[model samples]
Target: MSRQTSQKIAFALLTAAAVVVVVPIVLVIIYITIQGIGAINWEFLTAMPRNGMREGGILPAIVGTVVLTFGTAIVSIPLAIGAAIYLAEYARDTWLTRLIRLAIINLAGIPSVVYGLFGLGFFVLFLHLGTSLIAGSLTLGLMTLPIVISTAEEAIISVPQSFRVVSISLGGTRWQTIRHQVLPQALPGILTGIILGLERAAGETAPILFTVAAFYLPRLPRSPFDQSMALPYHLYVISTQVPGMSTEVQYGTALVLLALVLSMNVVAAILRSRFRRKRRW
Candidate 1:
């Protein structure tokens, strides 16, 4: 076959694959919105659940999800950024660094259910956190660390070598060069990774299941030590565990969860775009 024909065939195959991936996502969103839109109103948004999740709103679940996401960010971002900086800037191309990178890659591929079990054993049992928001947040932080570190390292490395050299030659310390010159340029990519990590942490069910989720908590948690009602766990409960659960309620829960994740992504996208537009080098 001619090169031109092969190129056309490749383009067609790629287009078909994109459609296959995207069509299902669009259809699922449409179906969920149609089923759940009725259940989303002032009362549904504000009020607490009643009659064992057959009535009332998902207020506690929403609050719990937000708190959990915040906690995970607090636990994850600084450590991940520090690790990324060390890997990208300070670490030499040695066996130790390579080993560390390999470990991070392996960590990223571990199943979510295994993270749940690890949380159960270490956070809950060993630390005596005992199925609370803090434990769950820690678990999620660990799960997301590899993503943040890898993205941030790549972002930092992408900054031009001349920028660092100029900064250092102009009497700036190594730390100063990284903080002022390297970090700013890398900020957009770092934010992208953080957004992706938070999205995953927010929507996860298994990791939180063993660490923080309460099956039917109607009241909002007052402290990190308290077990909270999260959206993913609540969806799992009502959709399967609760007998005769209202279909509207289940669909509404799913819609709200999707909305929460998508909203975070949208905000991150806007921020990243603004940063890119304003970026000086």
Candidate 2:
């Protein structure tokens, strides 16, 4: 075949591959929105949970999701940024750093249920925290830590060394250069990582199951120490708690969960794009 023909074939193949990924995602989103459209009413958002009722809202679950996700972000973002800074600025790509990186990757790869077991033993009994939001938040924080650290480290390290040199040439110290120049440049990427981390924390079920997700909590969370029901557990119950029972509610819960996570992902995408377009550094 001619070179032009081969190039066209390769281009077409790549395009096909992109479409293969996009099509299913599109269908899933469409399906969720359609199935969940009925579940998007004010009552659905405002009412309380009923264990065996035909109609009830997800107020506690919604609140629990927001609180846990935000709490996880608050807990993880600082530590992740600190670790990222240490990795990008101070830590060498030596055996220790490499080992740490591998451990983080392994943690990320471990099944969610395993994390649940760890949380149940350590956070619940060992610490005597019970199934509190604090425990769940911390569990999720650890789960998202690797993602945040790796992404932030990549962002920080991607800064041009010449910028650091320029700051140093101006008689700035290493800390000053990093704090003022490198960090500003890396903030967008770091924030993007944080957004993704929180997104992960929101959709997680297994860890929260053992940590904070209460079975029949009837009220909204009053504090981080409050035990509560959540979106993921609700979805699980709706799906498996009964067969041919409350399918609409099941689909509705699924839709709400899907929408919550999706909105987060869209926000992350927008933040990343916006930072890319208007980033000063």
Q: lDDT of all predictions, in order shown?
A: 0.94, 0.86
* Model 2 C-alpha lDDT per residue in residues 183-216, reported as the tens digit of each score: 9888788888888888888998898998999766
Model 2 Cα displacement at 156 (Å)?
0.9
1-281: candidate 1 lDDT, tens digit per residue: 99999999999999999999999989999999999998899888878899998899899999999999999999999999999999999999999999999999999999998999999999999999999999999999999999999999999999999999999999999999999999999999999999889999999999999999999889989899999999999999999998998788899999999999999989998999899898866
**TM-score of each candidate structure, all chains considered together:** 0.95, 0.94
RMSD (CA, Å), candidate 2 to true, equals 1.7
TM-score of 2: 0.94
Off by over 4 Å in 1: 1-5
